[model samples]
Target: MSEVTVTVRGEHETRVAPERATIRLSVRAEGSERSPVVEHAMRLTEPVRDSITARKESGVIVDWTSTRLSVRAERPWNNEGKRLAPIYYASIDLTATFIDASDLSIWVSDVSPWDGVEVGSVSWHLTPETNARLEREVASEAVGVAVARARAYATALGLHDVEPVEIADAGLIAPTASAPPAGMAKFRGMVQESGDMTGASMAYEPDAIVITATVEARFVAR
Candidate 1:
């Protein structure tokens, strides 16, 4: 049998400032009929579009797009000749990109009318510039960590010198967002609030995203 070889592993984490923001907004409309539900959904989504446009005009929002549109109908279930009400609902989802910190915060705070509208999720991002800077910082830190670990291992093994032979980056980590599925009733409530231009109590708190990277290194012992 061949001699066994031992490989060590090292990990490091760094918290870098986020340079961009992605805000996900879901607009919904509901009514007794499909046509009216769709109409109301469109009407309610107008303000959300307007809000995004306003932010763009004010140089706060960088980009915006409608990601998804869905319509759902729920028929009343009858048992023992009991009658129930039928429901119809529609929903629209949008994503707005913010490049400025102040604007991002303002948009998050001001994107109200949330009673019916469900704030799906929010994600922080690293802009190209910030990403480049962080890459360099993290790489340096990772190398230091690897070297320290190798040194410790070499000392424990009674080795005098340790030299790196290979270094390969595993990959970079990115932030992602996931929203819970919504039903017709929930969609309709959001649309109604927006269409009626009524204000409701809605509070949202987005989680912070932490990005990480890993590396596989091979070193020779002397």
Candidate 2:
């Protein structure tokens, strides 16, 4: 048989447990007076900040940050449609990364009931080194799949040899290659959170991270 072109797409996916959890929290206070609100937010934030710094030193927390205190004022309307005096709000946002998920749960449970502390969300992700390693492995496997597919096509055509002509990401080998496919290799992190009101307790749930890689290849069969 004469040389013929064969194009195929290969994909690989793997799921892994997350290695890090980053949580966001805000300390907020509101009142008819601006000064007291600001002071109150700052006071509530001190213990939270202390806990994060202590955890960082103990290696339970990898990193943490705090935003400057901010204040906003708004005049709310009552049922009578009368504009009331402006109410002042003060807030500060804080974020912390925990290497251990259990530590995150413990810390959140401790701070959640504070007068002005609010838990926002938790992000679960893999370490950079692990993600890179797994992505490379899956990409190589995808290439192998492309080769096997080309060989199968050659066999069906009564040919015995297949050789790779070109290889690119999921979109690069075809006329439609300009737009990369969504299945292409990417770094992804999952944001998940849950809570239970049982006895005023708290809970956290983080899903597994999934990595997928796709590639396109062109081969000659004869």
Q: Each prediction's Cα lDDT score?
A: 0.60, 0.82
4-101: candidate 1 lDDT, tens digit per residue: 12244444556655556677778888878889888888877887789899988987888889955699888776876765677887999898887765
Stretches off by above 4 angstroms in model 2 are: 175-184, 187-190, 194-199
lDDT of 2 at 124: 86
Where does the lowest 10-residue lDDT sum fall in candidate 1? 182-191
Query: For residue 14, what is the lDDT in candidate 2?
Result: 77
- What's model 1's TM-score? 0.67
Error of 2 at 98 (Å): 0.9
* C-alpha TM-scores of all predictions: 0.67, 0.89
C-alpha-based local distance difference test score of model 2: 0.82
Candidate 2 C-alpha lDDT tens digits along 111-204: 8877788888888877788877887887888788878888998899998888888888877666563444433456566776545322355556
Error of 2 at 222 (Å): 1.7
